[model samples]
Target: MYYIGIDLGTSAVKLLLMREDGKIENVVSREYELSFPHPGYSEQNPEDWYRQTLDGLKALVSVVDPKEIGGISFGGQMHGLVALDEEDRVLRPAILWNDGRSIEEVRYLNEEVGKKVISGYTGNIAFAGFTAPKILWMKNNEPELFARIRKIMLPKDYLAYRLSGSFCTDYSDASGMLLLDVKNKCWSAEMLKLCGITEDMLPKLYESYETVGYLKPEIADSLSMRHDVVIAAGAGDNAAAAVGTGTVGRNKCNISLGTSGTIFITADSFCVDSNNALHAFAHADGHFHLMGCMLSAASCNKWWMDNILKTDRYAKEQTGIVRLGENHVYFLPYLMGERSPWNDPMARGAFIGMSLSTSRADMTQAVLEGVAFATRDMYEAAGSAGITPERTMICGGGARSPLWRKMISNILNISIDIPACEEGPGIGGAMLAMVADGKYSTVEEAAAAIVAVKSTCEPEPELVKKYEERYQSFRKLYPALKTVYGEL
Candidate 1:
């Protein structure tokens, strides 16, 4: 039998076709437009997602026998607000996870309502990117549209509903919404009341691998697929990526150095950081995990190489820096504000400690080291929660760089394992589909069978010491500039 995993990303929908034997058969991607009507706001049409996904699926399975496709699942961008009316029509463009227009709403929730109360209800403090803040933003700024909302869906759930005709979401995805009682694995009544929404307005929650429904008749016909294809309730992109990396069991870690960087630490039981620096959310494996996210990672490198430096010779540029962590210049990577330990959206990027002696290579190396140092901030937060990861599985676009991976391993003083297949969430989605189809008994079993390590990057003791000292200096730069960031 075959399974399909739809990775509904921010910029595009990636569809993967896999066999039950853990072999990927085909992959297709379809890009869509992202709209920025105002500053700090990001929006997308729900219809574009569905249309692109359908088209991508058509191409994904063009050469396969459609009747052999047993199941479908998804891994998608989390926390975008997708509102629907009573007639099931999209009420407005989705408010994306990257959108920072809800700063005031975030402040109100964190200050007025209190972080303790919010954290007690949802196991997380309010951030500008969270769904709860977006809902408040809509309610306050677009009252007419908010009043017409019949259902509130996350970005991926909207696609799931369109395909399966079932209004459902998985715990891993729902946890990011700030509307779910993450520790209890249910919708939080207090959060619902605060959002001015009822439980009925939310999708029925399921475990990420649980079967939600079958394909709708029309959808099945359009794709020339079997109507009985099981639809599994998939997970948030990060959680699904963790599954893909086999970072399922307790004490396991996965570091994603994508456009946004994250340190995901899986735990056997529920654990929240004392400072609420990390997100405590339910994992796709039916356990709990803490996550720390940095808003800019590879994107920072892209900005420097593409826009500022005016070159795509990334390897050429990186080759000039043989000094590793000994560079005197330091960079603070807060290009799009920041998340994780800081949670300060007002924070901005800066290149500190530069002098006339500083070379172009020094600044370039600083950008890469800056991201690695920031990743260490999250690593330390996980340590505070009593979870020390000796080694971590690395994924994402930035992970392709050997220098960056080495930097992360040495700076954090942990081994970095590269996955044989770095498809991340897309592959994890297919693995979940296989589980939902009973090809595997549990997510762990599927992960153990499917995930393979390609190589390992170990930290050298000497390099580790140097990076540790550099990290100490990098840490102070942010606090010293925090007050200045607020004024800016």
Candidate 2:
């Protein structure tokens, strides 16, 4: 039997077909538009997601017999507000996870409502990207549209509903919505009351690997698949990627270096940081995990190479940096402001310690080092919670760069395990489907059977020493500039 994993990303929908034995058969990606209606606002049309996903699914299974496909699941961008009307029609373009238009709502939730109360209710404080804030933004700015909303769904849950004709979401995804009582694995009534929404307006929640429903008849017919193909309630992108990397169970960690960077630490029980610096969410493996996210990661490298240097030869540019931890130049990877430990949207990217003698390589190296240092910021926060990850599994586009991996390993002074397959969320979605189909008894079992480590990057003692000194200085830069950031 085969399984399909649909990764509904911000820019595209990537479909992956895998055999029951953990072999990838085929992969297809379809791109879509991401709109910016105003500065700091990001939105996407839900219709484009479904249309592209259907097309990608057809392409993914073109060479295989559709009857062999046993199940389908999703790993998608989390926290986007997708509203539906009484007739099940899309009420408006989704307010995306990267959208920062809810400053006022976020402030209200954090200050007026109080972080302690919000954290007590949802295990997290308010961020501009969270779904609850977006809902508040809708109510305050778009009153008519808010009034028409009969249903509120996350980005990938919308896709799941379209395929299975079931309105459902998994706990791993729902945890990011700021409406879930993550410790209890249910929606918080207090949060619902705060948002002026009812439980009926929300979708039914399920565990990540639980089967939501079978494919709708029309959906099955259009895709030439079995009507009985099960649809599993999949997870948020990070949690799904964690499953893909076998970062399940307690004390395991995974570092993702995609457009956004994250330090995911899985724990056997619920735990929240004293400062609420990390997000406490339910894991796909039926446990809890704390996550610290950085808004910009590999995207910073992309911007420097493509937008600044005007070069497509990324590898060649990285090759020019000879110094490992000696560069004096430092970069703040807050191009899109920041999240995680510092929830400040006014934070701006900066290049300090530059002089006329500074070369292009020096600046480029700073960007990479800056991202690593920022990752350490999250890592230290995890340490504060008594969760110390001695080693971490690495994935994402940035992980493809050997130099960056080395920098991350040394700067954080932790070993890095490179997965044999770095498919991230797409393969993870398939693994969830595998579990739902009983190919494996649990997510942990499926991950243990499927995930393989190809290589490990160990921190060099001397390099670690150098990075330790540099990190101390890197830590000071943020605080010294905090006031300047606020003024800007």
Candidate 3:
């Protein structure tokens, strides 16, 4: 039997067909437009997502025997506000997870409503990206639209609804909405009241591997598949990516350096930091995890290489960077503001300690090292809370760079393991479908059986010592600039 994993990303819907044995048979990506009507707002058409996903599925399964395709599932960008009217039509463009337009609403939830209260209810404080704040923003700014909402869904849940004819979301994805009582693994009435919503507006929540329903007959027929194709309620992108990299079980970690960056640490039991710095969300493996997200990671390097330097030769540009931790140049990786420890949307990217002697190589090296240092900040935060992971699986586009991986390994003083395949959430979503179809018993079992590590990068003691000094200085820059960032 075959299974399809749909990754509903910010830019596209990536569909992957995998055999029951975990071999990928086909993969297709369909791009869509992302709209930004305001300075910090990000929106997308939910209809575009469904249409592209349908087209991608048809292309993905064209070569396969339809009878052999058993199930479909999704791993997607989480916390996007997808509101529907009484007849289930999209009410407005979806406010995406990266959208920072909810700063005022976030402040209301985190400050006026009190961070302690939110932490007590959701195990997290407010962030501009969270769905609840976005809900508040909509209610206050666009009362007419808010009044018309009959259903509220996350990004991937909308895809699941279209495919399975069921309004549903998984625990891992719902955990980010600031509406779930994460510790209790259910919706929080207090949060719902705060957002001027009811529990009925939310989708039914399931575990990541649990089947939501069979595919809608019409949808299945269009793709030449069975109507009874099981649709598993998959996880948030980070949780799914963690499953893909075998970052389940206690103390396992994964670092993603894609358009955005994240440090995911899985735990068997639930835990939250005192400052609510790291996100306390449900893991796809039916447990818990702490995540620290930085809004920009590999995108910084992409901007530097593509937009700033006007070159496509990333490898060649990086080749000239020799010194790992000895460079005096420092960069703050806040191109898209920041999340995690700072939670400051006003923060901006910066380059400090640059002298006349600094060359192009030094600046390039700072970009890589800067991201590494930011990751180390998350690592230190996790350590502060008694969750110490000695090794981590690195994923996303930035992990492909050998030099960057080496720098990360040395700077963080941990083993950086590269996965056999770095497709992240897309692959994990397919694996979840396989598990739902009875190919595997548990997420852990499936991951342990199929997740393979291709290479391991370990830290050098000398470089680690050098980075230790640099990190101390790097940490100070943010504090000194905090007041200045607000003014800017």
Top lDDT: which candidate number?
A: 2
lDDT assessment of candidate 2: 0.94
Window of ten residues with lowest summed lDDT in model 3: 218-227
**Segments in model 2 whose C-alpha atoms lie over 4 Å from true places:** none
TM-score for all models, in order of appearance: 0.99, 0.99, 0.99
Predicted candidate 2 versus true structure: per-residue lDDT over 244-345, tens digit per residue: 999999899999999889999999999998788899999999999999998899999999999999999999999999899899999999987788889977
What is the lDDT, from 0 to 100, of the residue 35 in candidate 1?
Answer: 97
lDDT of each: 0.93, 0.94, 0.91
Per-residue accuracy of model 3 over 117-140 as CA lDDT, tens digit each: 999999999998889999999999
Model 3 local distance difference test score: 0.91
Evaluated at residue 23, the lDDT of candidate 3 is: 82
Candidate 1 local lDDT, 1-488, one digit each (tens): 99998889878899989888889899999999999998777899999999999999999999799989999999999899999999999999999988889999999999999999999999999988899999999999999999999999998899889999889999999999999999899999999889898999999999999999999989899888888999999999999899989999889999998878999999999999889999999999999999999989899999999999999999899999899879999989998889888999888889998999999999999999999999999999988888898999999989999999999999999999999999888999999999999999999999989899999999999999999899999999999999999898
Candidate 1 stretches greater than 4 Å from native: none
